[model samples]
Target: MSQNAVVDGAANAVDTQKGDYPDFMLKEIHEQPRVLRETFAGRFDAESGRLKLDELPLSTDEIKAIERIYIIACGTSYHAGIVGKDMIEKSARIPVEVQIASEFSYRSPVFPPNTVAIAISQSGETGDTMDAIAIAKKAGTPVITITNVAGSSMTKESIATLQVLADQEVSIAATKSYTGQLAHLAMLSLYLGQERGMLSADEVADAMAELEQIPAQVESILSETSIASIEAAAAGCYKAHDVIFIGRGVGTATCLEAALKLKETSYVHGEGYAANEFRHGPIAMIDAEAATPVVAIAMESETRERMLTIMGEVKAYGANLVALATEGDARAAELADHVIYLPQIREMYLPFTAIVALQVFSRQIALLLGRDIDHPRGLVKAVVD
Candidate 1:
């Protein structure tokens, strides 16, 4: 077989492989920490506390002139862009809009001059995403892409590209690439934030320090005994008709990603809402025995109290709540039906830790339902069309 044929065959074989793990979903889910570590390897310069984006083709002035950013992606990558939008806007003080590539291409949104268009995809072959890039390029917007495959269409076509180094993501449901994309975006946001004077030297250093510890923290989560609790919760909740995921700030990104995972893998009806937004309307859906399991990502930020208030309402409605809070967050733990204690990382960096829990939760639920965890129905490793 030729190289392309070999890759295609390996992707197909993912569905057929069976072992003590039972499914590709479980194996892919468990591979997260290792993949995260590998993604960050040699990408950070600890001595200068700078993210080395030497491969990216933008000068400091070019980066600094970026007044607007539009991120185009699909599915899981789109969810990661939602997180990236929040991070880049808050940290870099640059206005950003995230759009699904399919919708963006069809609608043809207005792109201002000096607008930076970022295309995010693991496969680099997503048709809609590539089409969106073509549209953006035609409109004279500078295009940059973050993708796994080096020579793929998106990489080859964009003005600049950052390779995610996620190496052959065979599983239909993305695990490591999602985290890898988030990590890369986080570092990029930090660099831009520092350049714009939005982040102080100390703040940049602190974030860099936290980023360095993520791989180790992820490794610990993968090896820890606490994963059993996640598995048990998944077994009990997978059959529910509807599930709700809620969080604030970066946690909202986690909530969105979790909903996507459950919906994609278990074929469960899932919705992710900002915790604050639930009060406006979504709360009506919450009821006793409703199985509206709320996953709250509570960090030690100003939004913590707001998230706690939202959880309070869910509790009053007698809705099942699953809280992912920091180690010392006693208030969130008390309100939740089940609380998963996470390491106390910085507010901005907490998403990295919370996502791992959701990955494991989705895998266990797929296993409980006796579904093929890796190759969920109606999905493919790459959307080549």
Candidate 2:
């Protein structure tokens, strides 16, 4: 039975109770595995090699005709769009452009006919995102929304909805929703790809198989042993005034959101840079007395070797290096001052697994700094206004 299912003996019946979990943030963070499973459940047919994006309004021919995709969102949702950019482009064989809603709103945009615009919002009430989609609709673009709230205003406005089953994510940091958006985006892309005849059945099945193992891998990362190691690493880095996260490819999304979590919760100067881009300017900030803590998402990918060279530059300036490596990557462990290993998964799907480690680590850093995590100062739960 799912966590939401009613037990025979229970009166209230369900997993609403927090049990012994103290902080809502921690509870929400750990709840991701369950929510992710829930999000994909009943949507995939393994034996038949089929994906069901029944929530998608457009048909196979409509997907085939899409010239491009424009994804607009804000905050964590925006980062998820970056992840979507990679997924949709590769899977569906289409070009994708991701825009921050506020930027997309003021700009005079021109989209070719049959272009689909996706506006992602957890609350379905972010004013800029709402406005961006409104403008897209006016220009005769079909809009689809990926949101957690069913019967939300955005859902009402859009042609179709991919509602995430994260339920109510009470914490302001956006844990499960980010992962949920990624899962939905992946599914949508694969569905489109299949319909468009771009992806083979075997390829789809392989990706689906990898996705099925994510919840268990996430569980491994959230385990007591894994959490203790990351907590210890955070304890070491908590005193640093500036924290930088660097990665390439899908790791870019990981670094971007991880940095946001740290800055939002702890008031630390946290920034993310593409592994190659870091050398251009940000690398200069790693000098003595700078005491910057570097969190490198060194998960194995085509860019793994390049990330190792970036670490060389970081070490040259004597910065404290924390590597988020893949499990059993001995070379990464050898190079960095500390290592927080994530369970092995496909590089294409690494962001979904890798970000969980950083999320847990950053929150522990916030707690070590004694910050009010649930109600971070100067931050609103949703940017509706």
Candidate 3:
């Protein structure tokens, strides 16, 4: 059932009980595999290697006519949009711009011919996202909303609603819902690619096969031994006053989401920068005395070499380095003070496994620092304005 079918739905489910897990955030984090499965169920055909995104209202001609796509969202949803932008552009061969909803609503964004705005929200009631959707619709653009909660404002406002099927995310810090968004966005991108003839049938099939493996891969990451290792790493670095996450390409979204989780849950000052962009200015913050924790997301990707170089630079600066590398990556292990090994997936899909590791690390840090991980201070489940 969608969150809307639940007792109170996402927006009012703040009092939702944390059944067995001590905190809702941890519980929700652990729920990602099942959430992803739910989101993927019935949407993909393994037999034909086709995506059945019947929920998408855009016809093939309409999708091909799209001049640009603007992805508008806020906070964790915004990070999901970043990932979505990458997936859509790379697979569908369409230019996509990810805009922070608050800024997008105020900015004079030009809606080119057949421009589409995709607004992502967990609660479907974020004030800024809804406003941005309104602005897009005012320009005669068909706004598609990817949201967790059905029957919420965005669902009604959008021309079509793509439910991520994460089912009532109770934690103020998003976990399962974010992964759900990624899964749906992946499917949406593939669907668009197939429709536009940008991706071949075999290519989509291969990607679908890879996508199908994500749930079991996530289960492997959530295993007791893996969680123990992540928690141990978190115990070591939770005392740091500041943390930096760096990556490139799709890893950029992973870094941004990881940093946000650390900052929001643990109250540590955390920042995310593209690895190449860091050397420009942010690298100056690193020093031995401070021992700032630099979490490098060197997940297996085209950017791994560059990330390793940046990790070397971080080590040279005397900063404590925590590397999220694919399993058995000796180079990352060689340079990192601590390494959280992740299950190796496709470069574009690494965010799924990589972010889960960071979520666990962030939760452990919150537990160590005695912060309320579920309902962090000064943050709410939905920024309803």
Which segments of candidate 3 are over 4 A away from where they belong?
A: 1-15
In model 2, the clashing pairs are none
Model 2 C-alpha lDDT per residue in residues 1-385, reported as the tens digit of each score: 0111111111112355566886778888998898788776766787788887766666677889999899999999999999999999999988899999999967788888888899899988998999898899899888888888777778777888887778777778999889999998989888989999999988888788788889999999999999998998898899988899999998998899999999988889899999889989888878567557888988888889989988878877888889999889988888788899898888878988888888888899899889988779988878997
Off by over 4 Å in 2: 1-17
Candidate 3: which pairs clash? none
- Per-residue error for 160 in candidate 2, Å, reads 0.6
State the C-alpha lDDT per candidate.
Answer: 0.78, 0.85, 0.87
Q: TM-score of every model?
A: 0.91, 0.95, 0.95
Using lDDT as the measure, what is the rank order of every candidate, best first? 3, 2, 1
The CA-based lDDT of model 1 is what? 0.78
Per-residue lDDT of 1-385 in model 1, one digit per residue for the tens? Answer: 0111101111112234445666666666666676666656676676776666665566677778888999999988998899899889989999999999989967859988789888999988999999898899889887778887767888767776666756667678888788878987987898788777788777877777788788887766676566876776676677778888888888887888898888888888788888888778998887686666666777677689888888898888878888887767889878987777777788877888888888888777777787777778988788867
Give candidate 1's TM-score.
0.91
**1 versus 2: better TM-score goes to:** 2
